[model samples]
Target: MSKEQIKLRSMIITALFAAIIGVMAQLTIPLPLVPITGQTLAIGLAATILGARYGTLSVLLYIAIGSIGVPVFAEFSAGLSVLVGPTGGFLIGFIPATFIIGLFLEKLGFTFKNAIIANIIGMLITLAFGTVWLKIATDLSWVSALASGFTPFLVVGTIKAILASWIGIIVRKRLLSAKLLISNDIKQSA
Candidate 1:
């Protein structure tokens, strides 16, 4: 395969990963205010596998598509209405979560310690943004917002982080190996 072929394959894979994230977002455990889903896990996987730039871009594209009337959000909600709705903060946090996680993945190479710490930090960032937005939108205090918006997500979020981190490291390694193998083949052919 040539360079162009590699680029094309990467782009396609990234898009498919993003699409998987979108579909995962729809598998919600219904909550009163913000539904819980496996979307964050997908975000973490994308960041760890795709690195900062493309990972962030993939997440942003997912948000954009869901915000523009695509039925990609939890519970099938879509459009600008969902973007500005009460759960919007969590939606927005996806960008930073993926970006920051990818940063750690790139810099620290996803060792067990780094994966644990990075996942914690990334999730904290997501919670911060989500709670702040929830408070502002609902006229709740910080504690109340956290109680309502972030607390319920605690257990499941932790589990997702652990699972995603483990899976992400493996997936990243595999993808990197595939990339190297493809490059070596192309070089030999050339």
Candidate 2:
């Protein structure tokens, strides 16, 4: 592909992942403190497939759309308030987590083991940011913040990370074979 074609393809793929993230966000299991959502799975998939730059851009676009009143968050909720709310940190954390995961996949090569490690690290990043934000947002104690924000989601998050890694690697391999994603597309941009 020509340079322009490559750029256009990258843009399209990034937008596609952004939409996927938005759609996944709607699959929420509401809880008293924090809701469980498929957002993290989508994040992992995007990062693994799109690499750091495009994946991070996709996540940022998702957040921007939601911040602008698009009903793309959990339970179809949106707007700036949703971001500043108790769960906002988790949403914000997706950006860095996606970037890190993508970076790992890009640098280490896309393998199941690498994907698992990357996803786990990404999950931890999200949890740490979310826990602190939850404490501040809810004025809860540190232990309370961990319990409400971190504990409840541990098992589910681990499962999601593992599943996302497997799914992402499979999808990425298929995309590569089909030429929908070039090998260079998965490389980290300087």
Residue 84 lDDT, candidate 1, scale 0-100: 77
lDDT of 2 by residue, 75-143 (tens): 999999988999999999999999999999888888888889999999999999999999999999999
Which parts of model 1 have CA positions greater than 4 angstroms off? 180-190
Give Cα distance to truth, residue 35, candidate 1, Å. 1.3
Q: lDDT of each model, Cα atoms only?
A: 0.77, 0.90
Worst 10 residues of 2 by lDDT: 181-190
lDDT of 1 by residue, 1-190 (tens): 7779878876787688779888888788888777888788888777766767777888888888888888888877789888777788888998898889877766766565566667777777788788888998888988889888899888888888888778877776676666631222111110
TM-score for each of the candidates: 0.89, 0.96
Which structure among the candidates has the greatest lDDT? Answer: 2
Best candidate, TM-score:
2
Which stretches of candidate 2 lie above 4 Å from their native place? 185-190
TM-score of 1: 0.89
